[model samples]
Target: MTSIEETAPGRDHFTDFDLDSPEFTEDYEQVLGDLVAKCPVAHSKVAGGYYVVSRYDDVRQCAQDWETFSSEGGFEPGRGGEGGAKLYPVELDPPYQTRWRNALGPYFSPRAIRSREANIREQVNYLIDGFIEKGRVDFVEEFAAHLPGRVFFGSFLGVPFSELPPIQKATDDAMRGPMEGRGEAWVAVATFLDGYLRARQEEPPRDDFIDVILAGVEDHDGNPCSWDHKLYVLTDLLAGGIGTTTYLLAGIAHHLATHPEDRAALAEDRSLWSGAIEEFIRYYASIVALGRTATRPTEVAGQSIAEGDFLMLSFAAACRDPKYFENPHEIDIRRKIAVNPAFSFGPHRCIGSHIARLEATISLEEILRRLPDLALAEGGEPVYSNSTIARNMDSLVVTFTPGEREGRTE
Candidate 1:
């Protein structure tokens, strides 16, 4: 695998695109736009090679037709087994995947997520209180990055908040660390999850999500899932809940800080925040691309994909397809999005999307209310890191008028 710093450039994107390349990280929107128009299904030789599906329609078709483009092989290109433990459901095909979704979906439904909004809002305000008085802060590190884990642990997963730091660090390293170190990072994450799950099993059942996971579901053949498989599911939830939401939050914060006019509009009209949140999710999709393997021979946008070939379905690119979204580059809060691919599509569509939206909406509302004068500080440009699975913002600094804390919570 090529490192981002060592990634060579000047290759034809249509024939040899690399998602991990610095080119993709720097010119993400442009590279995908060209591909969507010129070569909807472009090939890449990175990580033993794979094809990229850039257009909205093609990416959706591939994601929806999981049988033709199987995920059981894992979602990373080239590294395949080397990418660390397989995340359940996202890496599973139907029947078994469906079973898991059926068993767990209710916990993440809009209604269920809404019930936790108070908890989410409390955490959002609490985090802001920590930095509201500082007058300056790294938005990503100080706020966007921490809220999701706090909510996930406190409201959904029932884990101790103290356990979040190490798990969060290990998760970050596994996803964005050096190539050789990622696997070890994943092992550390897995070890933590393993113990957490076992400890939950030993305690009296709380009838919560964790206990539901411990109950275990049937495999395709009706066999009970392994303890390790349960850990995979839990790990996937933690990563999806925390890591992806962090990017969305950071992106929204950066946009608000840079475009005060837009922020003002949203601040004046709280109802617009919902649409703006959706627009932000579409514009700054957290997972840039995810891999799907050809279960057999298939064709996408006139490109012939051989059996067992890996394809990177660029959801970030799909969201920007001109055919699907008019004025694809601009953020239109009122633009009616018939279908947003930001959370992906088909059977494997993200189950935590409601959580993400609610979290974003609350965070945006609080930030604008508390940090209304928020603006980018001098030399404060967002730092980003790209990978086959996701794109993340590492830092975003902002300055705001100092505000008083609302007093500590019990």
Candidate 2:
């Protein structure tokens, strides 16, 4: 699809770009390519207007200089903290944000995440078993959407598996459901988190990730964190944990279904999986952009940014910058990458990145070994939904040769 710039002469991308608009979302690769090549720093009038930074060097510099471009302003462009709860650490600047990251960092370290590999594999197989006998399934609904929540509840947060449905539904609705009903959906999510945290406080320590939140960190003013502040931290973890990885999972499944050669290559060689996952992250990045506020006057890619002005660093766009990548659009699993901005950069880089990679690695390994003949359903096509902050494949139907369930070996 041609960019909106070509299709509609009046809507110049430099001044009238809307990340969430159908024009941009439907043909984002071409549109983002245009932005990177022509206007590295483009302005969007949508959501009260903000500047977008699209080049690889520009995004890295802005992300590294937190003092100049503060995150305390929030990540979403027009709507900051859409659900009414502030996501801490992410929405905070350094020193203060530093304290929180320092406290929570150990839990997401490679060794810590590595320990959960067994349970993660079990969860992956458990979901696959549900549809293995049927010869067909909606990968998003039946598989991708459920794995994160299961791992979150069963491993990270230590919630009961039975509680997954209501919380997961509330999160999905709050994130991508109808605009009118989002407020109520967010309320459900917040209410659940509040109750869960309060209950955890009264119980004996479990020495788990939630325990770290309950222990609390010093606030920006050097005082002990407030009760509500603690709630904000918990909210961030839950929201991040439950939803973000689904996009990567669904995208990979869809890619495998559509490209037989890529699937055949991956199925034949297991060693290719690591580089493949990183390439998938770079090529099919799910995070579109994240917002940062300029603290004072600064210049990025020759574009002047004033104090209090909003700037969106496009991680997806950075990954596609042609200067750094040869064929930025095509999926090359063996491609070498020095720096991948898929998880953003600097201190606010996704703490869950290790877990996300592990999940994708195990997921691809099992799906290929078990369902060798996976292909798109006869007439099924992927439907997508986009927001200012993230984009996801909503549904992907696939047909595979029916196989027997490898029931739990416990």
Candidate 3:
């Protein structure tokens, strides 16, 4: 088996393209269409020696067949190489990965999530009311971004809402890649969570997720999870639950604001919210791609890939693949969906996906019901975060018609 490090002497097809370019985000459809048509499995010299899989089936297969394409290295190539330590279940391959999954699964179950819906809704409406009086506000900061962070911090840990902003900012900075002065941001989150966990450790278990995980026994690992493991898991939960949900909500808002017809259709009939949300996931696909390393030499789509090769599975490209979706570029709420790997596939699929959907659905429904006349700020596009793992707009300024604020119940 040829090692991935052994560079093959071949013309790299995607050398002309730059993934970090803003044009790539703005004109992703055209770019993805071109990639799918010309080279579905193209070699990239710029991506530090990794083959890019742009087609839907190829990417799906990479995610499904965990044995062939292992995540032991980590998800993102850059991050995977950095820490030297793999973070819990996301970095572990099955049957070992199964243990981590099972341990965290019960807490995020549909029934467990439903139990927190009342509290989640309460926080959502509270944030909505805080900015509703302005009539025009940055939806991302004021609403979309704020909801998940507060809910995760406050509801999940029973923390005060006042403490959420600093934590949210720290997590956001950490995920958006290493920035100047951002090194301490992650440490800040760790420090805060450590203190919070220690304080809660002596108390009786409650309905919150922290309590569940702290008290719950490990099903596979045999020994109880150490406080360090619990902290890592909680950090993962906070980052995944808040960051991705914020991006999805922002994406939904962007799509609705830009596409008037779709917005009108959704506004008129709230029943279409489910389909619209699905379409949003397909269209924006909060994550652009997920990374994996080849456990051994493998052949995929007639291309010979070497062992220890880093693979970039293009989630954005896959969702827009014409082979699977008709009019792949079009955002159609009415499209009948079979299955899309937007939430991913197989054992490593998103654990918090159900909760993400619920949060997005509830947020969208409430926004539409209360502010039907919502419109993007004149002559402005939302500011998006430059991130590999999560696709998100930073700030979305929206103007809404004047109206009486609705009262929220817990």
| Candidate 1 Cα deviation (angstroms), residue 22 | 0.9
Better of 2 and 3 by lDDT: 2
lDDT of 3: 0.74
Top model by TM-score, which number?
A: 2
TM-scores of all models? Answer: 0.93, 0.94, 0.88
Q: What is the C-alpha lDDT of each candidate?
A: 0.84, 0.84, 0.74
**Candidate 3 TM-score to native:** 0.88
Write candidate 2's Cα lDDT for 154-266 as tens digits.
Answer: 67766665667788788778876788999999999889889988898899997777888888888889899988878888788767755578888988888888888999999
Which pairs clash in model 1?
none
Model 2 has an lDDT value of 0.84
| Model 1 Cα lDDT, one tens digit per residue, 88-169 | 8788889899988988888889988899988788788878888888999999888888888778776776655566677767
Cα lDDT of candidate 1 equals: 0.84
- Which residue pairs collide in model 2, if any? none
Ranking by TM-score: 2, 1, 3
Give the candidate number with the greatest lDDT. 2
Deviating ranges (above 4 Å) for candidate 3: 1-13, 16-18, 81-86, 176-178, 215-226, 405-410
What are the per-residue Cα lDDT tens digits for candidate 3 across 354-395?
A: 788788888888777777777888855787654656577777
